[model samples]
Target: MSAVRLISNHTLKLQPQRSSSQLFRRHASSSVAEGSFTARRGLYASLLLLSTGALAAYYFDSRAAIHRYVLTPVIRHILDAENGHKLAVRVLASGFAPRDTQSDDERLKVQLWEDELSNPIGLAAGFDKHGEAVDGLFNLGFSWVEIGSVTPKPQPGNARPRMFHLMDDTAVINRYGFPSDGHATVLARLRARFPIFYQEGSEPHASLRSNALLAVNLGKNKTSPVESADDFVSGIRAFGSYADVLVVNISSPNTPGLRALQSHALLEDLLGRVTHALDEIATSESNKSRRPKLVLKIAPDLDEAQVDDIAKAILQKSVDGVIVSNTTVRRPSTLTDANKAEAGGLSGPPLKPYSLATLRMLRARLPAAVPIIGCGGISSGADALEYAKAGATAVQIYTSFGYDGVGTCRRIKDELAEALSREGATWMETVQRASAELSLKPEDRSAHTSIAQLTKEAEELMRLVDELGERVGGADPSKDNSATESTGVLPVVSNGTERSDFVLFSMANARQWVILDRSDNAASPCIFATLAYEAIDQGAQVASSNSKGRTISGTLMYRRGQLLERIPRHAEASEKLYLDYKIKPTGDKDKKLIWAIA
Candidate 1:
């Protein structure tokens, strides 16, 4: 009976163990199921956030409140500047940037090169270092989208921390050194774009877009010889057919000796080679007129003489246009940013003055046919207008675009349009007017007499006058008695062979007065004689003539090139007068003398 009871207790214990084991299994299964469900929920939530973010990026305009208050701040705070720039480029390439919805007003249209651009606003080169974002930038409403400081070979460019933001000055400084994706890569991309762009019902060729143009800014590789034209020539051959304009970028300060290309000899060689390459491309093309316009981009730090040299080279080389200017190494005192001392080219408001001055100087030297594109420190429509007034056919924005965002082009266009309307003008009209008014006119550019030349001529004239005076003053008063009937003065008129007029007076102090008449011939010989007669009548001292005739002794004042013989102290010396001329006749039979001011 004890054995039977123990067996029953064992069975009872086994039953409880089985029930507890089943309960534990159920709990484990339930926990696994809940864990899997939670993970799936988290993944869905993440996907939703990503989709929302992508949508916001694509749909929102760069000018939207979210972009200004949120997106911009987020980008600036989250990423380093150079990386942020990369990210922006990537975003644009991905077609996530907002589309330019606004069409330009008719008044905003302008002509650059042979094309008629929808607006005068354009994106300058440095903004797009590669051809990766040409169409992307164009989508943002830039009529002219310039790409690449493209080199013949790939280059990393400068070093880390090479770019800085001067937030206080709304500027940027960069030592990018023309980082480019070589000619091969850039040319391949452009070639790809070319076919698609010109296809039926596709985006128009950059040249076909009226005033819209696509330009490639060619740069020399850091390791390449600075003076060699091979790199730029290669670039022209590679991209000549694909671009509307080809910009030879020899102006970047970051490059060790790139700016040296601005030297007359080097620039001549560079442009000549590039032009030859362009001609070759044009010759190969079925359409002869479809060649790219060649432009030269120069630095803002150039002096007047340097700029003049560049202008001469441009005219000599037959370059199509010039972009007046790239960044400057100069740091203005007005720069309040700590980055002011950074070692790189300075750009933004500090650059405006330098650029405008350079542009004005360049305009005065360049012919009206070659247009100048003004760049540097332009942030507003007013600034664009200022550039126009200074003789720019078109204006480009760079530092301002970087600081402000993609909406910069649109904003500038709006502002420019409004200003143009206020003046009852169009962009074409304003540019035309500015070009006509400010550019060097043919008359102003004509050969002028240098001060040295004028001085030399004046000295020669005075010497001749002195010899003539001796001839007249030493003559016998008795011989010319018939000629001295009126006031005992002889009137000598320059013969008809001369273009200039002059008068000679004999003074009592043994000094002869030579009136250099630089006036028009309206003053007849009779009038000139009256001047000498009037001086004697004004209590004038004279030499004692043996024939009882008096010789006038006093200074003669030529007022406004009109001969006025006056007694000493009769007129203030401060009066605006030509230089004094003294002459004593040398007894020459031809008493007529000529006066030449220049």
Candidate 2:
């Protein structure tokens, strides 16, 4: 009886339980009349039908809106809506011209050809001069790719049909100038599809993200030449944060007076400002643990003074890197791009030597610590080897990538690896070493070494002076010049009545020296003859010290007769020697000795 009673009560409570949210709400108004009692029921059914239709309409409308805005743009880009395919076609055509098509056997033979044949190749900035098909170039296999001379503003570049494909020469003549998609748009596209290296066992991305190494080249759209430095700095700041490396492209011949920025004052000012900006970004990024490299892409035609000045600036500002040799306005005596006669920088076969020369030249100007990424005129492995051997830290190929297909990078990597193994060096070490051996042609090497050379030479000269002193009793004590002014000094003498000699030694590298005055102490055996530089007390005790607080052990090399007689009757009387030192103030903390002046 209790169980039956509980069941009845639970059923009663379960009547029509109300929902937390809107559900079974009462109608706001009654429906219009239909015909009779049956008509009223029919009207209620009609209302339900209308409500369902209204809700379905709203859903379709919302979906349509989403499709129109969000989905369309992304799809359009993926589909190459902005004529993006042309970029691929152009890059393919420009990079691997002449051989619009190549046989498999010929492709296989390229790597064995040599460094001068391929490695570091060229892609003149304005080639795509418009931000078209960078993706296509990557697919063809370039170790690295450079795209755009993107400006702060959009530009159409020179004129229509400014790009000329020279079939015979296997090169393209582009006076397209620097067409750009502006800073914001291109950068946004690049960000969304940011490239990643598709290596073995690498983390995956959303879809077909690029595996190629990226370098985004920014250029001045149309220079207000007076504000050149400001333009470059702005370019650097705009794209400087996200790129793997930022290139300050003051070397483009297309922009008026752009090359003049290569002048010492202008170049230094520009590079100094740009690198400082890169560093600030680097520091902020380091906290996040990522930073872009800064590199300057210079022209091939710069004179030695210009190149030296650029190197001097790099050393002064401590720039991240440099890229040698861009396309040349100077035409080579060749026949590939007969239209090459058109007024534009000549690239392809003729540009190879010039580009390589620039690499060798820039290598000489920059310090070993500073890396040079050699580009331009490389169409084969031989070309790559030349750039590698010429002293580039890494090489980027553009034009040849277009011709070669995606296999280019793989082939070049294999060839470069072989070259490195044959030479018994790692890739980087190979460049540095091979560069030392390259007999730079006049065009490739700079003749000037002002600031850097002067500083190093002066230091070496000072070391020689010190070396000469030990051999011939020190530089005439009269020559107290500004030579030691820069670094700290320990004064040995100040009092007018007597002068004390002092030597403060610093060991930064290897050096050699031999003490003179052998006749002064014939009985004393050679204590540190093989020392080569720093004298060692082979078998002597530190008995006493002279001035300047440096204690050294040596038998009497000079002394009075009485002092010598104290040693042995047979010993020379004029022998005298003393470990050098000076009395120190009790307050100083780092002193090693406490010899008192007696």
Candidate 3:
């Protein structure tokens, strides 16, 4: 849901960050005074240092002044969370909306449906745990939003610091373990958003807020033994009447015994019963005309066979949709925090590729029409498009929005729009087709470079061989087949203006370029994307278009946003080499990517 809060910790981080900045400022001032010339001047500098030290000491120890000063004003900016919380209790709060024109102010209506987003995008399960923030999150603009892992009895979740912000890490480690205020608490919150009350048998549900398309992520209680179906059913049953969609969460790494529920036999039984229950609910509501969509959020750490098993279970069970992944147990090679040794799954940039990999696998194995909500490490529009390209129908962003705030959503949407437009499509469906052609799986990543380069080389060689056979003829076998075949031609390089033997090639002493044999250094899941930051330096035009050839590898091309084939790496070599294309310099193409030159 939204960056899984550690909700209170959001304020906690801000306090510490301010103190760290002050400490640095004090250190800088004290160091400069060491070079002063005269005794009187030195004494004055000492006094200034003392003043700085007191401020530094006060700040580092705790934010006594900031809490008294800054927080009151900051909270005031959000129309006062205090007042907003009151609005939660008082359904008839004044000044919600609608003071504008109607009949006379007719305008041309553009029925623009959001490019049906197929990226790893969806709301985190708990952001609207009670469905309280659904409308608000939608107002901020997201393709889809998730609410709840709502429990029947309501849960307080794990204890404090259950959620921690690993800031320098650009990650969050949380053990929130499905804390929710319960079905009634959320239904009340959502009901308050509406102008009318909702009738649930004799009960009523309504809210002043109701703008978001909701997907309800459900889980078993910490107290409940995950082995049993009764616990899960209890939670899912309560929200059935109100939820727009229901997600069976069998993969929260934080929750004890959560992954155990992911076992195929256990999962099939659970899903079968759950879907059956929802099916009956839908049937009963046929008169009322509403049936909540059923979806599932699984873990990223799952292996291929495990994914296949789950996919099979989903199919056999007749379930609805699937969210590709949850947080990761494996930390990345890029993790900079020494404190990262602490327990809990790692989320954010390190999880993007892994999450996308799971998504691609699901798309390949699962039946079509089984909608997938993508989530993990999506911070920008390009990242969203990458998820879309990887076969996500829509994506959920938690970390980026957590760090960057609500503005991140609009930024991602705008950027994704730009990406779609660049693909020569004004509509999202077209972009999705383009992305489907480009999606790559994780196992396909290793040979990305060699496969791409060799393919381009092979194409050039084939073209030349065709010309040679026609020119020389079979009568002069040496001049014909033997000439180019027996002796390989050196590739012609193109300089800025035209083709040449020597194009300016530079050697890079880049530290990151060193690829090690062991898993220790390359542990970062994003090592591929990290290397891709240097893709331009290799002077190649890379485009991901899903295609098939025995020699071509999938992993390499997918990183460039091209997923031409679903086939894994070839065990045997073939004449048709598949890989990224290395572009020769030409003034027109060379100028397009400025970074490629230097």
Candidate 4:
């Protein structure tokens, strides 16, 4: 009985040990499985973080190849032309747009008016018609951001499908018809861009960037009379204080009868009123110190006569600058895209020839003082350089910006810098040289007599001035030490001393004259006559002649209380003169200075 009981106890103990061994093995297996799962989770988390960082880096880099190759293509494929534009503006306004991380090359710097731009590349007006994405566009490295074809009142523009993309041709056509958010809405957006501690005097640029500019493109409302200048005048009043330049848009083919304003008579009236309004704004207390420059935007479809007439109006009204062209209504044979049949202005590679032709024609007629901003189908640095060679002070792009995505500005700038370096010239230098070569000279006149005839007339006028000086100041005509025999013009002096009233002299060509005020308290020391001596001769009555056949009966008309000093005198004529002076008629109050024959 004792042996049987001991056997049962041993069997029970053995069973319990077996159970313990199995339990130990199960725990070890479970631990191993948990460790492997944890390692996989860690690997996945690390991969996720790495991928996120890489994406962020790519998105921020303006020159990232992925933008041009992947993102832009995807967006374009997903959205239609108008939708894509809207999305772009929204993205930019939302501050998610890619930025240009690189600093502009020294070769890209351009001096325009009173400001120096970081680069010559600029975004044209149509891209941000409502002024919603000024800062974002600037982020892409555009030195000039022109917002709006903003009308006096809000407009819905044409119907849907108004915008078309010709992918094959690399062009776009739109009939937006000056669709705008109106002057007030756009003005609010511009004002909101100002910083918390904004000071107008400290930052003079409307763009709010030191090396950039903001321009407002003014367009007329379709509901209003096409012949009236009221809308444009109102635009100047509304945005004049907020913009560096005010573009008068009279060229959009989308707007009915808008092109009519470019006619000779209509243009004259329009420019006259516009300049008057600008002057009023300039003289106002709010903008007395600084006023926005006035620029005229014209169409690409103008004929030679139309271009000539436009140039005449620009010179006659003293328009500050000119934008060479807007979009064209014509279609090129090279356009194979199905959307080519759409009726609207065409822009892109095809429009280059027309824009270039118009630019060359107008550039030849206008003086260099009037800068031309070329806008057309410029897709690369070579394209921009072509415009620069044709006398464009700066160039603006639209269709290319639409097709090429955010990296467009950076890419073009890089290409332009390389091209300029290869040529060993800066943009400004190139433009200056081109302009000097292409533009008309002061001596060119189909109606006026030859320079030799004018020179003879000037010499005769100088002899008359010598006799007049002798009669007035009682100084011998020949004994005056300041008289220049080579120039054949006598300097106005009192008893061989510089006179305080004014000094009058004729240029060797007799086409120009100079007036100097030597008074101790004179505000300006020099004043140049703008009208040619031939005009003076034709208008003035020859009252009589002195014993020496010298006549001093002509009248000199000049703007009153206006002074222009430090004119660089002609190098060949007078060594004493340090500067040349230019005088333009302000169309304001005039005072005549008359010298009578004795």
Q: Whole-model Cα lDDT per candidate? A: 0.69, 0.48, 0.51, 0.73
For candidate 4, give the lDDT of residue 289: 61
Per-residue accuracy of model 3 over 203-252 as CA lDDT, tens digit each: 22111223235566777778877777776666556666666667888888
lDDT of 1 by residue, 477-558 (tens): 3353223211122233332222233333333322344443333221222233344544444433343222212122333333
**Candidate 1 whole-model C-alpha lDDT, 0 to 1:** 0.69
The list of candidate 2 runs beyond 4 A from truth reads: 1-139, 194-212, 285-287, 335-337, 404-406, 414-426, 435-598
Give the 10-residue window scoring lowest on summed lDDT in candidate 1: 570-579
Every candidate's CA RMSD? 18.2, 22.2, 27.2, 11.7
For candidate 1, give the lDDT of residue 166: 88
Global lDDT for candidate 2? 0.48
Q: Which stretches of candidate 3 lie over 4 Å from their true place?
A: 1-121, 195-212, 285-288, 430-598
- On the 0 to 100 scale, the lDDT of residue 224 in model 2 is 60
TM-scores of the candidates are 0.65, 0.52, 0.53, 0.73
TM-score of 4: 0.73
Cand. 4 Cα-lDDT: 0.73
The numbered model that scores best in lDDT is 4
lDDT of 3 at 394: 63
lDDT of 3 at 57: 37
Worst 10 residues of 4 by lDDT: 570-579
